[model samples]
Target: MKSFGQIIKANSVGKVVDFDAGVDRLLPFDFTATNTELTAAMLDDTELFSDWINKQLANNNARYGVGGYNEHRTIYSRSAHFDTSEEPRRLHLGIDIWGPAGTPVYNFYDATVHSFANNDNFGDYGATIILKYEIAGYVFHALYGHLSLASLSGLAENKFIPAASQIGALGPKEENGGWPPHLHFQIIEDMHGLKGDYPGVCRFSEGDRYLANCPDPNVILQFDF
Candidate 1:
């Protein structure tokens, strides 16, 4: 049997977020501890963090900022949602495409709505959706997080969603878990009986385990840069 990455490479998938590298530029962002420019104060204030994001794009002449898979991000320190007394979940498990709010998000493959929910906690996913897919005898799932609340209005479990269909739009800071507007795209090999959400970040110690369950999203994204 082919692995999920192999299956993805064998098949063509659509853009989870509308982007054209040929015409539009994508700036890779760094949220790791080494990026001294992103101070603890700036991250704690959503407006400041958002301003910094926009500045990077403006200065670089890029349309969107993208990155954060397997990254040890320091930005999570701003919210208690990602931290526990025992461990702090700072290692990101998804690829984040940061852009303007209301940017359209599409399905990468023909899929069924496995689940949907508004994970409204501070630093949470906000509006989230999970799509189930079966390809070449392999079954897996894709998760789209930080979506607008309106995206959940007419969705239902088991609903057929065509490839490249517009399923949702990016939500604003107030609605998208108080972060800069971005789509959190993750590929999960197993749902583990979870619904509507899965851990998009893990503690540094558990990186190997979480990274296995959530493969690199770029396998499906196929972005050139």
Candidate 2:
């Protein structure tokens, strides 16, 4: 079977946002140790992280700070949520869009609401929504996390959401699992029947398996960075 990324590339469907910027306008954000601006203190402080993201946007004159697909980030160490007995989950499996809170998020294609929930935990995806889509005769799912809690309201299973429709807004720190305001978008080739939520980060040892299931979200977001 063709990979999800390949299928999406051939279809030439819709987009996740209504932005008019090209890939050049997209800025790359670094949350790893190589980013001299980041520190242990900043990772745990929402205000600091938000300020850092703002700086990145202003410095680059970009509308969005993107990247982090398959990236090994040191920021995950701040939360025990990613820590496992054997290995830590430092590898990011999604494309994070760093932008202002309340930025509207749209669906890349027509889909049905698969599930949603307010996973109110420290360093977690507070409000999340998963959409089920079928393309090229294959069924797949998309997970939108770190969204405003209000977005989950009125959502029902199997609810039809039109392509490019406003699905939700970027959430605040308190509502979005205490992180800097951003959208965590992931493309899942298979959900394994899971709903409402899925792991957006994984351990290094499990990178191959998780990366296979969760392909590069840029295929849907279409942001070059």
Candidate 3:
């Protein structure tokens, strides 16, 4: 496996955020490790942070969403946001690459389309796509929520997304699943009862349960950025 930072690249060059122009606020490993509340097991025991950072990178062939809410919504999502409480959402499963509308997104790796649907709603993945794959002999699935209508048009079960294939594009705030325009990428070990969509938002009471089913997106996209 490769380190997350080594696999993914900055989606947009010179995109500024906070104080840096043309640069998004990248996330470092310590952001999750240093947090006392985060369970050690959830993040690979604080050493490697699960070898899947490439999942978050943006190749030139690919256009990563490039905004830390400065250009788009200016808000942020992170695992640290999830607490032990049963609040609606305790953590952010995927790294949102914020950029303008119509940016193309690529699959981090080869995958089989497990399930997809138009789960459009306020704060929901308007057009969601979930791809199943395996790593280290372990079966898993990666989901791309909040996709554009063009991305979701005419899909089927068990679709194939070749490694780095252009599968979808970033949606705008008007219909990108109710969010202010960002991608919600998540890694799941088990689908549970979820079929076309899964619970990205949880009640504070179910925080612990969701945390178990969904791990950190960094586990796949190890990029601290």
Question: What's the TM-score of each model vs. the native?
Answer: 0.97, 0.95, 0.61
- The total number of steric clashes, by the backbone 3 Å criterion, in model 3 comes to 28
List the candidates ranked by TM-score, beginning with the highest.
Answer: 1, 2, 3
Against the true structure, whose TM-score is highest? 1
| Local accuracy of candidate 1 as per-residue lDDT tens digits, 1-225 | 677888888888888877777798888999998899999889889999999999999999998899999999999999999987588999999999999999999998999999999999999999999999998878889999999999998899999999989999999988889989999999898889999989999999999999999989898987766
* lDDT tens per residue, model 3, 2-54: 43223223221111111232453443322332444334443433122212222
TM-score of 3: 0.61
Better of 1 and 2 by lDDT: 1
Over 4 Å off in model 3, which ranges?
1-91
> 95-156 in candidate 2: lDDT tens per residue?
99888999999888889999999988888899999999998887888899999999998999
Q: Which candidate is the best by lDDT?
A: 1
Q: What is the C-alpha lDDT of each candidate?
A: 0.91, 0.87, 0.55
Q: Which prediction has more favorable lDDT, 2 or 3?
A: 2
